[model samples]
Target chain A: DAGVTQSPTHLIKTRGQQVTLRCSPKSGHDTVSWYQQALGQGPQFIFQYYEEEERQRGNFPDRFSGHQFPNYSSELNVNALLLGDSALYLCASSSGGRREGHLNTEAFFGQGTRLTVV
Target chain B: QKEVEQDPGPLSVPEGAIVSLNCTYSNSAFQYFMWYRQYSRKGPELLMYTYSSGNKEDGRFTAQVDKSSKYISLFIRDSQPSDSATYLCAKKRNDYKLSFGAGTTVTVRA
Candidate 1:
């Protein structure tokens, strides 16, 4: 079975510009969540998508948004990117949504897209 | 204070030695604890997970959780060069989101 997959392994964007990162969840998984890992830091949750709608979100501002398609693929869009936006964008997929019980809800991650804002 | 706090250690150890990593959390609502290992320029891979206040062993990895003390630990036995990676301690509550600590970078020298 194929694991989680992300597109454009590396990307460079300019300040005030916009960028979109893509993710395809693992087979048999229904939920997709996005995370940002800054240099020398662990990943911070961005948001989670389920049933083609955003179900949970973290501390990120409105500039960061995402969409989940019927096929379970997801796209993360960052508008008016800032220099601090440079980080590793990771996509993780799990079996069920937040409404489901937490037990055995292991999330598998993709290699992540490296986003650099110049 | 951060929800989860871990030492960012560039800890170096000889091969076949035991590698210990620890993290502390301030939230008692965090019932699920996990350890993830990430290589350079790669996403984190889950290594071990535990829910209760005790120990769970899997192969060379043993994860220990102390709910009373709000502490969690991961131990790698007979570590190899391939075991060198950044170790992340993560905690989760009823929500699906995870709160992670600053990862600890470990190097196992051959």
Candidate 2:
């Protein structure tokens, strides 16, 4: 069985441009989350989508947005990207069951997309 | 102060040594704690997960959570060179999001 998969292992973009990263959740997973990991830092939560809606979001600005499809696939879009936005964008998949009330579930991650804004 | 505090150490140790990584959080409501390992330029992989205050051991990896102190720890016994990576400590916060600490990079010299 295939685990979580992401597209465009690496990419380069110009500052102020927009970029889109895609992710396919692990088999049997229902929810997807996005994270940004700067160099030498741990993954920072960006947002999470469940039931085709963004359920929870991190402290990121509105420029960082995401969409989840009915099949549980997800896409993260960054508008007016800044050089500081260059980092590894990670996508994690988890079971949304019981997530509404603080119940936690294990998350599986995909190999991140390395986004570099020049 | 950040919600979670961890020492981002580039710790070097000899192979077969015991390794301990820890993180402390300010939020007492965080009930689920986890440890994730990430290699260079790679996404993090969950290494251990613990609910509430207690210890859970799986092979050489052990996870411990102290809810009273708002602290959590991950211990790796008989560490090998393959274990050289960045170890991150995180907590399930706000139900779906996981607040993470600055990962500690470990190098096990073989």
Candidate 3:
């Protein structure tokens, strides 16, 4: 089965422009999570979508938002993108039951979209 | 202050060497610990996960969680170049939130 898949493997955009990144969760996965990994940094949680609703979010600003469709495909939208917004946008999918602390599942990730805000 | 702290090391080691990566968190409430491996320009893949305190071993990867010390570690045995990547330690801060460290870059020379 295909693992998490992302779109626009690489892209360059001018400052003030907007960008949309897409992702399809791995097979049998029902939850989708988005993360941003800057150079020399680990992936930072953006938010997680379950049952087509945003179940949780991180310390990101309003400019960063996302949506998950009925089919478990997700899209991340960033408006008025700044240079600092340029990073490798990763999409991760988790499968399994939920627990108190964690969702209690293993996560698979997409290769990620390399966004370069020029 | 960052919730999780990890040394971003470009740690180099010879083949078959044992490698250890660690992270510390300020949030004492964090109960779930995880380690993720990411290659160049690629997304991170789950390497290890453990709940509460103790050690969990899977093959050459061993994940240890010390809740009392607020520290966690990932050990790789018989390392290979394929294991060369950034190892990120993460913890669940709340019910559905995860906080990740800066990641440690490890290069295993084959």
Q: Give the clashing pairs for model 2.
A: none
Error of 2 at A115 (Å): 0.4
DockQ of candidate 3 is: 0.67
What's the lDDT for residue B25 in model 1? 96
Check candidate 3 and list the clashing pairs: none
Please state the CAPRI-style docking class of candidate 2: medium
What's each prediction's TM-score? 0.98, 0.96, 0.94
Location of the lowest summed lDDT over 10 successive residues in candidate 1 chain A:
A95-104
- Candidate 3 lDDT over A43-97, as tens digits, reads 7889999888898888899999999998999999999989999899988898652
Better of 2 and 3 by lDDT: 2
lDDT (tens digit, per residue) of candidate 2 on B56-84: 99999999888888888999999999999
lDDT of 1 by residue, B1-110 (tens): 99999987889999999999999998787468999999999999998888899999999999999988898999999999999999999998888788999999999999
Shift in Å, residue B107, candidate 2: 0.6
Q: In candidate 1, what are the lDDT values of residues A38-93, reduced to their tens digit?
A: 99999999999999999889999999999999999999999999999999999999
Give per-residue lDDT, candidate 1, residue B76: 96
Please give the ranking of all candidate structures by TM-score, highest first, separated by commas.
1, 2, 3
Each prediction's Cα lDDT score? 0.93, 0.89, 0.87
